[model samples]
Target: MDLLTLLDPLMTSPLLYPLLAGLGSLDGVLPMIPSEAAILTAGVFAHTGAPSLLLVVVATALGVFIGDHLAYGLSRSVLGPRLINRSKYARRAVAVAGRQLDRRAGLLIVTSRFLPGGRVTMNAACGTARVPLSRFSPASAIAALAWAAYMAGLGYLGGAAFVENPLLGLAVGLALSFACGGIVELVRRWTARRAPRAAGAADPGRGRSPAAASRGQVGSRRVRRALVSATAAVAVLAAPAAAAATPKEADRVGMRSRLDDVVATGAVGALAEVRDEHGAWRATSGVAELGRTRAVPAGGRFRVGSITKTFVATVVLQLVAEGRLGLDDPVETWLPGVVPNGRRITVRHLLDHTSGLYDVVETLPMPPGPEFLDNRWRTWTATELVARALANPPTFEPPGSAYAYSNTGYLLLGQIIEKVTGRSYGDEIERRIIRPLGLTGTSLPGTWPRISGPHPHGYLPTLRDGETHLIDYTEMNPSMMGAAGEMISTTRDLNRFFAALLGGRLLPGHLLDEMRTPGVRGASYGLGLDWWDTSCGIRVYGNDGDALAYRSWSYSTEDLRRQVTVAVTPDFRGDPDHVVDAFLDQAFCG
Candidate 1:
């Protein structure tokens, strides 16, 4: 069953939902799951779900209490013991506490229970102090009950209060969790006040033995060791935080607000690039895809879709540079009598996409009207898809007429590149372009493994029998888009490609002029680039692409200073333009 379908009822059903929700919170794998909201949803479903209010309280109270305490116990057993063996201050503290307990007795272990590690080690400490289990169990139970009541009360009230709003629900959940965690700490201190007087723990008058005092000295040394151990333990635990603080750390730690906005807006995922020309700093966000954990690798490969058209334009321009092919060379000269109006249409017209080619999508229905082969299919020759497209025909527009984005023109270009270069399309891209520029992250996979290295599994949204699922779509046949849209790239590689392309590294000076030359109509698209002077300040030149559940786009400033911003995903979402717009808008350079 799909996740949303499976989770929805537990969210909407009051009776079973709270119990499940509480249990769900105990799972640490993804603590970010909105467990409180899940319970609040249960409250909303109270009319139909009929879980008694008290039942929710009991279930939630018991679940969180038991779970948290278990977490503490596990920490003591594993973490606390590990600390004492290695830590100097813990060793020192153990020594100090041992000396103190020898004279004043039972003070260190009992007091140690007040510290963070102490609370965790309370059960173990009581046992070590030689305090009987009967006494320790009753006291710890009382403390545990208080802790549960406070947490559960907060949860119940928070859920009841924010049944209508999820954002509010999350706030309340965190507050309650913190409040409960804090309260447990507070009560332990208050309970410690009457300790020495209530028990003759340190009294020489009491039946305390010399050996017993000796035991306290020994255990106190252990306590000193435990203190150093605990501090070191805390430091080790804080390492992830330290790692997150570095400038080169995750872009999230730096710009969570901007990233949060993207996710809130519901694009499967997004990545933002914020940088200064002098190589100062940049941040990234949202991640690469939905339902997966890998962030978009900075230098990695992803399909750029129609963006490949621009590269083809560059290659075609290179051929034109050698005087082998002319801008006005009839396509018929290269491939005899294939196009109906091949005699009239020029290579320049195709590069400019003015070749009035039929839209393959309009002709051949998209997502190709199949369940999209469950198994990853491989090795589709470029000509196969072109033949299917050519079997249909050109647009109603005469060659060299109006501007129309056509995949057929690009497919023709790939064949042209292969025919001219006498090498595989991908090999030519590497030898001529990527390898020369040091753009290792970029690749023309051409049905090679779809983008390797750390990356989130991309997925496609599908509704089957009325249930929605984001299906992992990491693999696909390049023949579908062929030369037109099938090149894979990463944000870093794409940026580098644009940097080289726009900086006049890919093509000769005059040919680069043709490459930058805009097309007809109000739109002046030069080859592969799509230009839009937004109401916002920066003038962007790049491509917008959509394939299955994936959407990708990249842009560079006209000067190539802000080289590229590419957002790609494994799963498709309803709105990509908005995703791009929002990211660019928030990317006000520092």
Candidate 2:
């Protein structure tokens, strides 16, 4: 076979079948892959009627099923462990995941097949939870069969349509893309809504973890596994300014000036936009860690860390308005496998951090390696992280008994969202929150590294044995965090989103009130919002985010009359003190 002859399309006619199969497999690994296109093209080739539609459908399903599992397993082995060390919050999230897996084993596998951004590496979720291959494999096959059949059928229909009218094929393709995008958006919102309550802290009556509760149950299991599978870990600050914040007059232009110079110099390659009660723009500067790209705007893009909780809470309350899940309902009512005492804690408790799930992070065996210090080269699975959290005993207290910022709380809520909605967390977010609010620049990043717009440089000071070493904080993949702190976004979008949420656009009035209700001695939580009253009498609601080298935030007044978003890349050095400070001077020039 001469090289030219082999390259000839006519000479390679028989290669189409396997080639088509490969495309389906590719989509399993890379969610964005065009499995539909490959099938459609294959259908065109099937004009000769050689490969029957059934055979093609089987091939596509098998390829996708196998590829998805392979990727999932790789996530467990390669990605999950590394992610454990990425952030303290991430470690905590893993703990809740463990309990959820134990109880909702069956549903977790099924949901993976239907959800977007979820299917990409679901194998790892199942694997890390130590779920047997026997369980996941069959469910995965059945689910994939349905998915492949639907997609293949569409391809067939489109093929027939294309022969009659090419426009119809194009229209069908557009519809599928829209459907995929819509579904993704819906999952995002649902996940966001549930994030603040992931640990099942909302229901104090339940004593077993979601993972523990889920291992055995299916319709309800689907809800449990879906919710538990998506939620991530936790602790959060109450307000931007605590008693620790040195109270000062609104005239802090000097401090604001210093922070701006730091950002302009790229010493801190990011800035926070804070507006005083009088509505003045103030700047706090820092770089966004991760990939240190200097071309970031003052309002740059970053992995918004735990601040995502606020968004999730807002969406949950909105759902409450629609009566999807009631605020007072026991989390156990919606998600079956929640910790044993979960019935005692209401959704309200989980959102308020009253749940007393164990602090999984401090207990887990921290890997003894330089990877902990490196900013970029780390990965982890939800299950591994959860296991580490559960390695130690849970908090001695009962649920809703006291205030603890365990990441497990949020994981519980994530499970709740899916159970009540019959949708993935990511899908719910897109359909309910992001699309409606127009937060175009935000996403659940999962494993995709498409931070397309301009962003600041984020620094992660690598430490080896308590000293600074090489900081490899560049382009770190953020997948294993799941819904915890895994969202990528811009300050501009954050500001807009918070504005919509606080202004009463996102939720009904009563639900919004419930969302803002605080508990657990009011250390610093209001549903999903982290709150503080500035000395200037400005009541601000927002959350602080810290993920790896990136620190980002979005805050606004309860009235939505004022808003701010800050993105920063930490130097891993001096005080990360008020990343939100620098309230601009009350400079409304006469």
| All-Cα superposition RMSD per candidate | 28.5, 16.1
Give the Å error, residue 141, model 2.
28
Predicted candidate 1, C-alpha RMSD: 28.5
Model 1 stretches with alpha carbons more than 4 Å out: 1-256, 278-282, 287-300, 365-370, 374-378, 570-573, 586-590
Using Cα atoms with residue i matched to residue i, what is each candidate's TM-score against the true structure? 0.54, 0.56
Candidate 2 TM-score over all chains jointly: 0.56
Best-performing candidate as measured by TM-score:
2
Question: What is the C-alpha lDDT profile of model 1 across 354-444, one tens digit per residue?
Answer: 8887655444322212344432443344566556557766765677667866667777777777677776455566567766776544545
Give the runs in model 2 whose Cα sits over 4 Å from its true position: 1-258, 261-267, 274-295, 364-384, 465-467, 584-590
lDDT string, candidate 2, 1-590, tens digits: 64223434622466665776677777766767777666665554454354677777788788878776776565444454455446565444443333333232334444544555445545544444323344557777886787677666667666665555556765775477457657754664565456432211121111100000101000122232322222211111111111111124345545555455434322345555545465535343432333332233443455776776676676677678777778788866876554666577688877777766664334322212345433233444444555565555657566666776666556566667777787646556767776676555565544433232344444444335554432434344454344455666666668777777777777777766766667766576768777776767766777767554566556677766667666655443333334235432121111
**What is the alpha-carbon lDDT for the whole of candidate 2?**
0.53
Worst 10 residues of 1 by lDDT: 207-216
